[model samples]
Target: MKKIALAFLCFLATDSMAQVSQDSTISAKEEIEIIEKDTLFIDMAKYKLTIPNNWKIKAGCTEEQCTANSPQDTLGGFDTYIESINITVNKLSSSSYTAEKYANFSIGYLPKVVKGFKVLEKKRLNSYSYRVTYTGSKNNIEQTWRQYYHVRSSKVYIITFSAQARKYDHYQPIMEPYLASFKFK
Candidate 1:
């Protein structure tokens, strides 16, 4: 009786495992369609980004053009509702600056310059990044901003995502992929 019970339990467990594996199988069409993506490569900067087909790239002042001393370049675009997303690469002149110091210096002046300035999160990402999020009012509208500072070779690549406070969550799904796509060459 003990041998029979043990054999039956083993059979049931094997059947359940087989069922789980069968349920997890992916169809060829699903695999191919879901894996297809559109990507953009910036040859001058030696980085590539993946963007959804619906997003449009807008012409605006890039980082290099905006700052006199910093050698920076910016790529920005908008979604279907015209919400803006931007990535700016700023090549700092000093290699002595650490990610923590840079992040602190960047946010230290925010409260003075921005209304309702609040730092939401500040943490390190690997050895070369300091990710930060803050909220403030811009032009009388509450806005949330997320920034990722990638420090490499005396350069800081700042990727910024901003949206009205209420719409911030709505745009997160899109913004997350855009943020993750940033690469330094």
Candidate 2:
């Protein structure tokens, strides 16, 4: 496993005011922009992923399974990341199953494991690939997830992106390239 932190602070926090007064509204002349950004590129044998600089690499992660997590919010919940991506490499026990089958199996079982699981979209490209987007809640926090499944060289690679429901859209751009970088070795 080899990792590189770009160490590029992409944000230019040029804000004149920290908080807007509840009673006051800014005029059209006022423009405030705040950006929090950084990313790390990690290259592994099976895949190469880019993650936010603030995200911590999970202790359980190895060459077989890799996971990176975003920081918890001010509320301080136990759920690992307000947003996260997990990639797992699974070896086939038998040559009978396709990635489609593995993906569907996971989709079917997800609701039982994650509370309030509701699938919003599902796309099957072929017998070899599948993708799904869903929302679920765990530990009192609602979350949205987009998962991808693909098979190559007799191995099924599953990549999952999870985020707080409120932040999913905001975080999607950041997670996109990371998810797309995965492929079976």
lDDT of each: 0.57, 0.64
Scored by Cα lDDT, where does model 2 land? 0.64
For residue 49, model 1's alpha carbon misses the true position, in angstroms, by 2.8
| Highest lDDT against the true fold, candidate | 2
**Steric clash pairs (candidate 2):** none
My TM-score estimates for the predictions, one after another, are 0.65, 0.68
Q: Compose the digit string of candidate 2's lDDT tens values, residues 39-66.
A: 3544566666655545666654565687
Name the top TM-score candidate.
Answer: 2
Query: Candidate 1 has which clashing residue pairs, if any?
Result: 64-72
Evaluate model 2: give its TM-score.
Answer: 0.68
Off-target runs (Cα >4 Å) in candidate 2 are: 1-39, 72-81, 125-127
